[model samples]
Target chain A: MSDMSLATPRAYRRPSTRRIQVLALLTALVAGLILLTLSCGRGCLAPGDVFAALTGAPGADASFVVSELRLPRAVLGLVAGLSFGLGGVAFQVMLRNPLASPDIIGISASAGAAAVFAIVILSVDGWLVSLIAVVAGLGVALLIWTLSARRGAAGARLILIGIGISAMLDSITSYVLLEAPAWDRAEALRWLTGSLNGAQLTQAIPVAGALLIFGGLLAFTARDLEALRLGDDTAQALGVRADGTRLRVTLAAVGLVAIATAATGPIAFVAFLSGPIAARLLPGAKGLLLGAALVGAFLVIAGDFVGQFLLPARLPVGVVTGAVGAPFLLYLIIRANKNGGTL
Target chain B: MMRAERPHRFAGFAILLGLLVLTVGLSLTVGARAVPWDEVWAGLLGQIDSIGAAAVAVRVPRTALAVLAGGALGLAGAVMQGISRNPLADPGILGVNAGAALFVVIGIAWFDISGAQNFLWLGIAGAGLTAVFVYLVGATGQGGATPLKLTLAGTATSVAVSAFIIAVVLPRNDIAGSVQSWQVGGVGGARFDTLLPAVPFAVVGLLLSLASARVLNALALGEELATGLGQSVALGRLMAAAGAVVLCGTATALCGPIGFVGLVVPHLCRMIAGVDYKLVLPLSTLAGASMLGLSDVLGRVVARPNELDVGIVTAFVGAPFFIWTVRNNRMRGL
Candidate 1:
């Protein structure tokens, strides 16, 4: 083992340095994106005005736009984005399949479907919707888990089954939206894909709570998860319980994603894209949960800004991320195939 | 072996055709407003003096469209699965439906394109492009188009294309309502004139699909073996794929991207007809038509006063079967 460690010494030493640099860079990028989101909407606000408004511009128009409108929107984006990123990367790492992110594997789709059904059919509001989503999300994960547990590469089977499941869930969302009263459609559209358009500070609370609790659990298991990646037997030999780690990771990831999805719809591939980007940024790095979280936050905030201000027409943040994600998905598939489906 | 199997296959085909006829009858009679069985016969005979007869009159074109579109999608799916040699290959799963949808939406949005002819062309072009692109991306890897790789590529393309569609449709409220309903995949408002344009394409596609069954059987014995038996594997795959694309694009244009009719039908047919593509293809068409017709009838019956679309119904009905297939089959080397 010592000889093995010594032979690949550069793998450890090099990534340690790169991880710090990369995480720091991602943090800075996320911060910049948050600022950008806060400052721009219908009309761009100056940096001074944004800071001033955030501080105590109670009666001013800039203050309302910044504090009331933009602040909640930014907070939701930050929390939801981080959660999506963390959950996405954790699932990918746990499953050892790059394509097995929660968004692609029907977790987010089920959550979004639940949220839509709650809002449209049940006429539920706020936290109840999120609760339904989280439950439904876990239920779907369980269903897929039991269904795809045949002997073979469970990871590949999980993705295929998830695709089938997601198709059904997505169509449910559409059907609800279609049956939804005209007044509900504009809001229900967010459930089909994610959007931060009617941002509310209240919506961020449950999501942030999920982030803190689930995110903490994921961080605790990160080491064991990295060990499990080396192979289950090796992980077991190293005193790590593979099943325990998988269960914790699955719970945490599903919780994070369900809450985030309920708050801001599924947000279209933010969860799907974050982990791969983080992996690319810090190649050979083991624990990418934090880096992916930051990347997720960056993509959400930046995507929202692009949809709101960069494009001629105002679009949802999900649309922007979806556009970016599709090409990246293609690139990843081609690359993963070249490497025999291992990233 | 052939002699022994022929009787059973023919019996199975007869049953499916009988089911298809029953489904049409059910579709004609059962709806938000139920028509008497005797009245349905009169309605079919063009006596439209009463509401029941008029309702039956309304259902005639819808039933036809559903059958044709369902057959088209089911046949397309069988050909795709055959050519790709992957059970999961369907026009919807393989990005052809999405490709057709994106093109038709674009044509409506940008070119202000109208009429069935224009929609048909745009949809076919889009389906063809997506098919070619997915093939290039999926087939280029070391193993040449494995099922998993191709599926991933197709799913990604579908995801991306849909995002584009949402971006296009969101801003324009004028087109959004119409486009949104269309996207839900229904045969509700289907009319004879509007349905006519697709018949030619559907017939051509049907002929091509039926003709390719022998080629599919040949190709199914592994490419090298098929070639050894004097089959031009490339030509056969291309012709089959083209037929699938035309059928899928045409069906998508008419029905607005109904999924799973193709994916589930062929699998069910294979169970009934065995692995013989010749037997499976025709059975799939009949079975596909029956399934869609039943779905449409179920949609109308389940949600009275506010009918659900066949597309949504198929999705709900087919998804369980899809999960079952995944669980039962091996994902590798199939």
Candidate 2:
């Protein structure tokens, strides 16, 4: 159906059986991690008890832990992870750089800064901050897009500009937190260091809705994403409407991660880490949307598990992901250098 | 064009020095309580007659500390950029401050250590190790540490170190409460006694960087070119990096990881001093000092009665400048 399909990179042309196999495996892994997350706390409910609790088995303890606490948390882990994974890969593919995740590109940080501002300065609480986060996330992403697009969407330039903005926002957020009444310090810190400890259905529901809506939109625009991957001039020649596709992708991607960040408080490096790991897993896999999203889900769930149960003390999911993801980031840089590829 | 610009290089440094002196005056005279010029002058001469005198007494040391830390950071950033040949290079950008912060936190939490003096040693060790680690990681593989790789590696290292710091600090409420100010990097608490010890280290690092200005100049032309032109590129880089680490470590110890001062100051210096390292190095020192002093003053004035950290102020001031640099300039790759 596409005239310029031949010009697309071999990896981007179509997903092979191997890619499907990888995605299947990642889905399976995400399921396993979710089960582990649901059952691994306190009394450590047996799998049967967890299943019973899920199916309305009338036990107060199991139901409270599973339905009220762990269920929303597990659901959020899945939804937020999926959003970051998909959004990250979208940006990476559209920008044609592995490093251009929402985390690195000022989107998540903007949400964080805004949320912090709402909390510390305005003295707001609860899910209202999340709404502000989404607006701020979109606003910051738009600003970054405009600023970086001055000459061209060169990957390095975009990344550099994103970093500068993130740094500025981070400082402002920190100042607000520092100036806030001492009692609010712990709360601000928890928010800054992304956690799912008090995960409620209220937070998880909106994030899940965002994932479903944006995820559907991305699937429909899949052809444009593949076309844009072939390069702007070639995609334009192929009747792809390159800028339109970019705008659509950016809008959907930003919406996906903005909600996820609002829900999870910018889980560090899951968005940055998932795409490359997904690409590694499938090798020749192109259009890594599903694989990356699943991998992201797995990372968050697993990282949460590790943070809560694996360490001597309970740490936040963001802490574990950051600790784990940064090393992988360094490895990618090294490998890219070794391959003589422009990072 | 190069020959005609020789005499003007000194003029750039001269202008920066004058600006720095003016900034010092502003820092003293402008704050929560605005002291008149005569009161500030009288206070400086130890005439303790009025409420303004006490205010000036507290601000003078802070202003001086800002000058010292800012000059050190700016010089450190200049040297780091020159050595790495990466326009984006800054002590904070390259994980040096994060490294220093991590070690300082560890020293405070684990060893029951306190004071700027102990932090200085720990900061130096941590910064030195981080510099080596980032360089090794970035320099490995085919290209031997391109600007992109170094920046990426530096960023990764900083993230990793910061995560570890959080992991350590989060559990201890007492540590968390006290460490917040240090984490953000401020000079508000500077006193005459606290500011005295860091001076020697900053001065030594400054002299070392200034003395090696020629090596930095040659190395700026690329490693192979520098080598061909009778410079030991590796040795020059090592010396420059050492100087940077020391200066940055001292500043971070004294002021807690104020970033972007180093990152932004060098570019301003380069613009004024042309491409000559001999001029850029000294001009950066003055520019850094003046910029930080002014930023500290701005921080105090903006919030009015409540002060902002110099680190926060510098980011607000420097980030736009950094973004503009990226947008407008075709940066030279190291």
Candidate 3:
């Protein structure tokens, strides 16, 4: 492990205002990247055409591709990515564990399980199924939180309980699938792995609305989240309502995760990787909420774009994300181990 | 001083023996059919006429498969924990399951291999190749096969292989169906004929692990200390890992990736038997067999006539147990 190098204390030194300027620049860059992702895809819609389509242009093909096909998918990706990024940051900060994410903690699986059950057993509409998924996801999160709370929710204990819950949910899902018809099984599998294909405007609207609501709530608690990084006692000492902040954060994370999962299925690893990527990119930042959201959006959009055009036969966005995220997870593990750090 | 440990050790041994008997009994009696205890006993003892021919065939084959698969998984778990020195380590963590699954998928997708026997070797080869790949990957990292490095490497390999499996097989619905079910893990499709080649591998692996139990105990103290104690740390690790690969590969190939028994059972055994591999290894085997057999029975009973796969049943039970163990500090340290 590398020795910690402490900076010498300087009394009352006023920092330059350049940090704000830099952040503003980075934000612009991220926005530009998002716009670029929207324009560059299989649809071959020019930037002007996409803008014209967005502004109610007269061209039919441009409007159809942009409005009917590309727009919904892009908007869903943006919202889902924001949800995952924000949720991941909140979870990691609240739990004080980098590996803490909706997917890893069984939230996504629970949502997927609920959605599958709804699809296969109850025969409900997709929206009602997604609502059930949100409830199921929250249920799993509450269970893990309650179970790990007794020991003060240490990172390891939380992870262990999460893993256990995940495994159980997975098994139950499998058991359900086994009893389901073959077509249902295939549908469930597709949903479980996650896909952005055929994401209609209806799904996109609710997901986007959820992201806006929850993302705003997360932004409101940004300062508390930053304080949380200094540990619970310190955050509490700093007049932050630690428990309340944790609860709200947990709820927000779950809400975001559930909505995203409902819309796009459980796209794996974006929620897990986004926070770390943001933290790494924006070193010395007090709050990672905005950064994580940007990174999450970047990852999802990039992943979707690659999935669409990278291979001869287009793969699902989830597959591409898994392929990318698996190596990143390994890197995190190795880095943690090398530093004698716990994940 | 060493003599003082004998009574506790003996008690562990007794418990292990009891578990072995119980597992055998449970495996025979519990299945799709409601075979009474007396009939099960008669069937085991060659008094098969007591039961109908159909009942005998179904119960005997299923029971034997359970015991064989369960026992193999248990032993494999012990070997993996021994080699990795991590309580969380399981056969699946080393990519053995994924590797086997990938090959089986490949066999189904490309070769159109259908029967259990035809794909058995493919599973084994896949498992072996994955183990070797994980080992090489872990070794290439800064520290050679340190617990975390090995785990990371194994996990990465598993993901990569699993991705490959999904990519290749998902487009084809038939192969996807076969691969998806197997990926969930099970002991249901196993037959004695399918278990034949794997049995020798399991036996040899188990024996090798048992023989190296004391060495493992020393190695567990830390590799540097083991080296200082005149043990060849590298050789000990190699033997233990090879033993793990064989047992895990064979078990996965035969039964298609039974997950948490290896993860949860060894920790339970360690808590009961107190960390001496001499005791932990054998106790883990018995405990693992019992756990899987009992889970298998529950799988049958839970759905009644429908029947759940044993792997899912084990996960449903094992995950909670693993959580409880971790919470209780029983699975502390590793």
Candidate 4:
């Protein structure tokens, strides 16, 4: 074991140094993206005015663009990305599989399905819809847990069942879209693909609150998550309440995912991509909670910025993430195969 | 050897007979215009068939299309699972459906191909290309095409293709109706022409699939063992995947990418009859046809004036059944 550890020089080093470096780099990237986002749209708000508008200056169009349009989106991206990144970390840690993400495990799809049902079918308010989404998200997570309980929710089985459930819900969502009128179908489809466009302060409020609550909960459990990296039995032997910790973290992760999915439709691959990016950047990180959250936020903000300004017409943030993330996913698969197919 | 498999084969034969009866009954009696049993019998017998040509034309083709498309999808799914040796595998997973939909979107946007028959070959070509691409990408390294590797490659490629489809098609309002209908997946627009073009393709694909089933069963054990047993594992996998692509592409060209039935029906069939592909494959075809036929009928009946797409109705049924199945037994690894 010592020899094996010695062979992988980077694995045994203190993680905080790498963590700080990654966090610093991500913060810089996000700062640059914010500047770019502010500068691109009509009239090119100067950095001084952008800051002033963000601080709520009165009677300024730059204020309207910064505060109403860009700020909400940027803030939402930060929160949602953090939620997705942290949620992905929690799932990957608990399930002991790198491939595990909220979307892959059916939680985001469930939340999206529930939210859609509430909006289109029940005609509920947005906040109420989010509430129902959280409930449904937890419902799905619980359902998967119960179904896989007898066999102890092996990583592959969890993913397979999640895929099945996700497919079923996606089909149902499609059915709902079909049943809706043409205009409603278009709107629903847009929402399903996830966009940060036209996010209001009200929507941002709940998302922010959920993020703070869930983020804090996840941070508190980070050490236990590191323990979980060892096998369940070994972790238990090391005085970890593996089952209780897993259950709490899983619920908290679902809460974060539901909040994020409610804020932005599943926003393709943010959850799946963030953890690996963090892992790559912070090579010896004990737990990827903070780094993953930062990376996720960066991906979302970057994707949103590109979609808003780079494209001829503003595309959904999800589209940009998907376009960017798909190639990365392919790379991950190839890398995994090259590394002997363990992932 | 074939004689020793007789009872299981006989059970499949019995299920097929039952499915046939159920399908006929579903077609004759259930629909928006609820015809009486006597009238249905007369219509079948060509005695009181003075009904409007619209009703006869609509009902007959719809029912026939459901059976044909459903059988094709189920057969395709079983074949895909067999070849991939992955229970989670489906034609959609391989990007065949996405590829067909993408080209169909392009065809509608670019060429104005209104009729389904004109687009059938395009769909087949698209699906075949995507399958080949996935195979090539998956088989790139020394590990060669493991089931999990294929699934991951296929999934990633499908997402990229689907994103491309949405990006291109969503902004074009003129083709929105066509694209939306295709996406929902239905037999609502099926005609005799659509059914006819797919027949030869489905037949050939089905035959190829059955011929490769025994080899698939051996391959399922593991690639090395199957190779040791004198099976050309790579060749068998390619043939099986080709069969699946042909079956799915042809069917999805006729119907839209109808969901759930392909992914679920095979497992249900396998549960009823043990996992002998010879029996499972044929029974899956029958079960798929019956399930889709019944779902289409239910769609017509449930919504009254407006019809639900058969794809939607299947989820209402299939999702619960799937959840129940997972709850009841231990699902194997992918």
TM of each candidate vs. truth: 0.95, 0.92, 0.85, 0.88
Off by over 4 Å in 4: A1-15, A55-61, A337-343, B1-8, B37-56, B110-114, B135-150, B210-240, B267-279, B302-305, B315-334
- Model 3, range B1-334, lDDT digits (tens) per residue? 1332678778877877787677666666666678766776666666768544345455556666666666667777777777766665677656677788788778878877776555666776787788777766665645455544565566556656766666676677766666677777766665567667566777777887787887788888888888899988788777877676667666666667777788787777776767778877887777777777777778877788778888888878777876775576643322
Interface RMSD of each: 1.8, 2.1, 3.3, 3.4
Residue B269 miss distance in model 1 (angstroms): 1.9
C-alpha displacement of B242 in model 4, angstroms?
2.9
CAPRI-style quality class for the chain A–B interface of candidate 3: acceptable
Candidate 4, B-chain TM: 0.85
Q: Candidate 2: give the clashing pairs.
A: none
Model 4, residue pairs in steric clash? none
Per-residue CA lDDT of candidate 1, range B112-164, in tens? Answer: 99999989999889998998998788776567787777888889999899889
- When sorted by TM-score, best at the front, the candidate numbers are 1, 2, 4, 3
Compared with the true structure, the alpha-carbon lDDT of candidate 4 equals 0.75
User: What does candidate 4's lDDT look like per residue over A1-343, in tens digits?
Assistant: 8997787667346567766776888888877876777655755777888888877777666887788787777778878888888898788767766666787778888999887777778878767977999999999998888776665675455665676688777776776666666445545656777778777777877787888888888888888877877778888888989888887898789988898898788888899888878877776645478888888888888888777677876677887888877787677666554322322
- Candidate 2 per-residue lDDT, tens place, B232-331, comes to 8778777888888899889888888888899899888777767788888888999999989999999999998799998899988888887887787675
Docking class of 4: acceptable
**Fraction of native contacts (fnat) of each candidate:** 0.62, 0.68, 0.49, 0.40
Q: What is residue B142's positional error in candidate 2, in angstroms?
A: 3.8
By summed lDDT, the worst window of 10 consecutive residues in model 2 chain B runs over B1-10
Off by over 4 Å in 3: A1-43, A46-59, A62-65, A126-131, A150-154, A337-343, B1-29, B33-56, B93-95, B107-160, B271-274, B330-334
